[model samples]
Target: MADPKGFMRHARREWPRRPVGERVKDWDEVYVPGGVLPFVEQQAERCMDCGVPFCHEACPLGNLVPEWNDLVSRADWHAAAERLHATNNFPEFTGRLCPAPCEAGCVLAINQPAVTIKNVEAAVADRVWADGLAPPRPPERLSGKSVGVVGSGPAGLAAAQQLTRAGHTVVVYERDDRPGGLLRYGIPAFKMEKAQLERRLAQLRAEGTRFRTSTAVGRDIGAARLRARHDAVVLAVGATAWRELPVPGRALAGVVQAMEYLPPANRVCEGDLDVSPLSAAGKHVVIVGGGDTGADCLGTAVREGAASVTQVDIRVLPPAERDEAVDPWPVYPTVHRVSPAHEEAGELRFAQDPDADARLFAASALRFSGDGAGRVRAVHLGGVDARRRPVPGAERTLRADLVLLALGFEGPEVAAGGAVAELGVAVTRDGTVARDEEYATDVPGVYAAGDAGRGQSLVVWAIAEGRAVAAAVDRHLMGATSLPSPVTASTRPLRA
Candidate 1:
């Protein structure tokens, strides 16, 4: 242990966010730059370093949490970065985007507040880059094998980088004009700057991973042609078939899908556009979902100067703290989470809720009313009970000039002539590509990973899948692999 009584000596101090008033005016990340470095060592010292270390198991990547915490506490950043990179491909992405289920499973969380695992992780990742500890590891010998990765999201990128480092010629194909997939377009700059992504991309390029952008595998190039060109093909296409809210006025002019709204705003930040065509400036926005994507929309809308913003969640409000009876120790619990966007919305008093939060819990949208020009004007809502049954006399209405459906995704999008269909991969009833425990598809020499095989999930899970699938592919080609396989296809989270 870094300090035997460290847990007793230190109190959890989370990373501080910039002032709400100041942060909302720009697209920079909410956290104050270099703010955690001073207190991060103390926070790292708080790791109890338990015998079993549930935090390690809770992570999808099986990250060495306690070990790295000790390394960071001792200020051995080089050793800490080495340990951090042992299992995870992109700590910067997960440190910023992951919800950190590992923290929820922290041994200290069983009693007192959890250690600042996420904050320490973010600090270590940033330090690695600042100190130039991370460098490309180009393979010393060529394996004479080639692999084609379809997608440029977290999973595809991770797989390509690992395969490249393992001496295989790897080419990643992306439908977008640029790489990074959702990291480049779906996520806003305020959450994680695109520069972080570019840095990693540069490292991958230096390590011999080639990228082919604006090339949809199933559309631009035939699946058979791709397979003929490469010895193996790995599908990392993420879940893009968004869920729909088929309510009244679904086709109204002002109503749009969350994916439709977020990308344009990101493009504006990329300087491709002066302003988002669907800008929420001076408009009342209603987001119909309560997931991370919805929170993303809430923040983007707030930054765009929305007149008012309200998020509608179908489930009831979660408890302030974890309910041990429902979710025991080491299991991810359901609790109220206040993201930076929520804080900004609360500070601005943009919500009409009694608690002044931007969310409306246990509410369902019944219909939408439109203006004479086919634009949405209002949303009709009704309260629901535990069983999702409507409550009597709880009907209400809210004015809404813009409606964003953040209702999540179904599965991988298998368009009429997409790669999935051309490759003859079978899709499961859950809408994901059918795969064995080894991530092998029905077709020989073809594999599936990430959301394409596991359904929509967190970024941590996507990276884990990417790494695991690479190992599987390597083993198939070389008859053995020294690469680490963190998780399998059947692996499930310790959730309630």
Candidate 2:
């Protein structure tokens, strides 16, 4: 600390987002371009540097929050970035997308607003990127141990980077035409522009991380063939089999899975299409789910010029404040917080459709109906109680020219014939890949990480697992290694 009284001296200030009226018309980051650095530095001083530092406990990567807070407060951007990178390989992605569980565990949060840790983290990343402090760190010597990292999402990318930096020749494989996985195709541009992802990928390339995009391991080349080329393999393919509604009219033309709808929409941003075939333009769009993916659809619908957009969630609405009784401090509490997408969607509904509420909590979708042309026309939904029991006379129909299912995923998908099934990987009851505490699968030289091994979870957890699995792979190849261990495959906060 710069100042012990910093939290008291300054009120929490957030980065200014562009005007809603102006931002909804385009697909770009919503925050104002510059001039917020001084404010970010000041916010960094709010860390109280507690006796136990519960922030570290809550963070999956065990990020050195107080250390970087001090460094940033002292205007040591380079050192701050280093400390940040020591734990997290991609702070920019976490800073933008993470729910900031560390902030929930902050010492200051007990009495007052927590230090704006997310903002400070993001600012340091942006600062280092602009000043050119982030550069390629190629290994001094080759370990001659080749590792094949399947999937190019956060987990795979992090594992490939760490393994490569440790002198191993790492090659990442992605089935998509371009790498970056969901980061490039699933997430909307307004949340995180693809440029940040691409910049880091270029650094990975310079550091000798080879990438083979548009090549599915089990499809393009046999799994045994892939294993033959590499000494070891890291399976980081994420949980992608989305949940579906089994109600009637599901086969209608306009009904699509969230992942299916989002990829083409993202491809439109990359200039692959002048207009997405699944575009919600001039249509009444209804999304089913209450999670971030649903909100992503909500924002995308607004940007696509939908006539109206609405979401129905079966779960009860989250409490405005943390539920101290059931979910005490140091845990990632389930609470209501508005996302950037909610802001855009809120404006769109308020301006375009005055009669509609953009989101419905304590509601469940019953069925769907189609028009004569075999296109989805309406969705039938009903209000639900705390236990998801239907409320009396609460059923209603909503206009839905385009229906998108933003429901959560159902663990790893292996049955439809992929690398996991091809390699004889064991799966848990919930459909996640089975691994030992060391993240080693039943196969001797093959390992797993991210959603594939851990089930569907947060990005921070994926990054931590990636780091841990890399160390395990390193040790397996070298007998002993010097890699840092952030977490084990089973490590996590209670109920986090």
Candidate 3:
């Protein structure tokens, strides 16, 4: 356990981010490099190591939060990394990307600020690499069984790693030219550098996990062929079918999905492209969604020198603090968050909002107007009440040379001749692949996990599903297995 009085002695201090002025000029991550290391030990000390640690339950991965916090506080980096890795395959990704509901479930957060769990986790992840503590651990023996995993995202990668380490020959298939599904393309460089992903991929390769890039299972290789070649097949295909905004002028030029915009921008960073064709340079951008994806677009546009960027959310503004009565301790709450991108947007005053941020809450886009060139020129918006009914006389318009619809995703892309369609897998009414609690689909010797099975969710959840599905596969193959199953297909977050 950490210091008993540490919470009282120290207030929560977050990892310092680079100044907005400098960060917006380039795509480097917003955090000050090595900033967390200086104070992370003290932050870790704030963990109460509660009698009933709810942080574990709050996290979909069921990461051993208190144990790692205690290890980090004791300056035991190796032990902390091991503890973190026991459940989460890629703490580096989660440390940077996860929203950390674990912090909201912290006992200290009942009245005081929660410990900087994310910061400590990230610091330990960095140390694992810097200290050479994460050398490839290839299995000593081979199981002689082979498995094919579709998609190379967090879930696919996690399942591949666990199965490979379990002595099974694992091959991960990726549709993109490169391995990482969203990690390499959908996510921007500023949020998490590609270098971090590359290092992990290198380790996986050394650990006997094979990757077949640019191979779409249903198209490049038939699903039947893949299943015939492997003893078992795991589908970690992610939810990527983006939801559309069926408003006027949606077909206009410069009106695109968030996936379309983000990937090109990331390609630019990967040196595959000199510049993003959809770059927001000098354009007045209107991103119609206030989720993380919208903020990502806002930041990317700001860095691209957009004339202005406004993020519109149909939902009303969340409270600054959790309403304890409605959202009690140990349950994730709805609260306002100021991401680094929001800070940059606020500092630049790129959008006109009374709160000095880029967000425009409780507002719905009514329509989009296009110019003579068929390019979007402006977006018409209207205020909506709690019931999403339009408020009278509350309509307005904003110039929008470019509009990104970050309206989230519906489910996996089960297009005609896609993996799901070709495999004849059962799909739920929710559009996700139908699977049992063990993550097995109706088809024999085939299983589904991650976003494909769980629907659109967090990175932590994807990794958890990956680990859980791997255990199920291993057990089915060897009659019994030793892999950890942190979650079930039916498991949901402990949030209100």
The parts of candidate 3 lying over 4 Å away from their true place are: 352-355
Report lDDT (CA) for all predictions. 0.93, 0.87, 0.92
Cα displacement (Å) at residue 374, model 1: 0.8
Per model, state how many residue pairs clash: 0, 0, 0
- How well does model 1 score by local distance difference test? 0.93
After superposition, which runs of candidate 2 have C-alpha atoms over 4 Å from their true positions?
A: 350-357
| TM-score pick, better of 2 and 3 | 3
Candidate 3's error at 124, in angstroms? 0.4
Residue lDDT tens for model 1, 1-496? 8998998999899888999999999999999998999989889999988999999889999999999999999999999999999999999999999999999999999899998888899999999999999999999998999999999999999999999999999999998989998899999999999999999999999999999999987689998899999999999989989999988889889999999999999999999999999999999999999999999999999999999999999889999988889988889888899999999998899875645679999999999999899999999999998689999998889899999999999889877787788788999999999999999999999999999999999999999999999999999999999999999999999876
Q: Give per-residue CA lDDT, model 3, range 1-496, as digits (tens).
A: 7699999888899999998999888888899999999889999999999999989889988889999999999999989999998988899999999999999888889899998898899999999999998999899999999999999999999999999999999999898999888999988889999999999999999999999998987789998899999999998989998999998899999999999999999999989999899999999999999899999999999999999899999988889999888798889898889888889998889985545888888899999999898989999999998689999998989899999999999889998888888788999999999999999999999999999988999999999999999999999999999999999999988856
Order of the predicted models by lDDT, top scorer first = 1, 3, 2
| The 10-residue segment with the lowest total lDDT in model 1 | 349-358
- Tens-place lDDT digits, model 2, residues 272-373: 999999898999988899899998888888889888888777888789888888688768788876777777777656222242347777878888899898
* lDDT score, candidate 3, position 13: 95
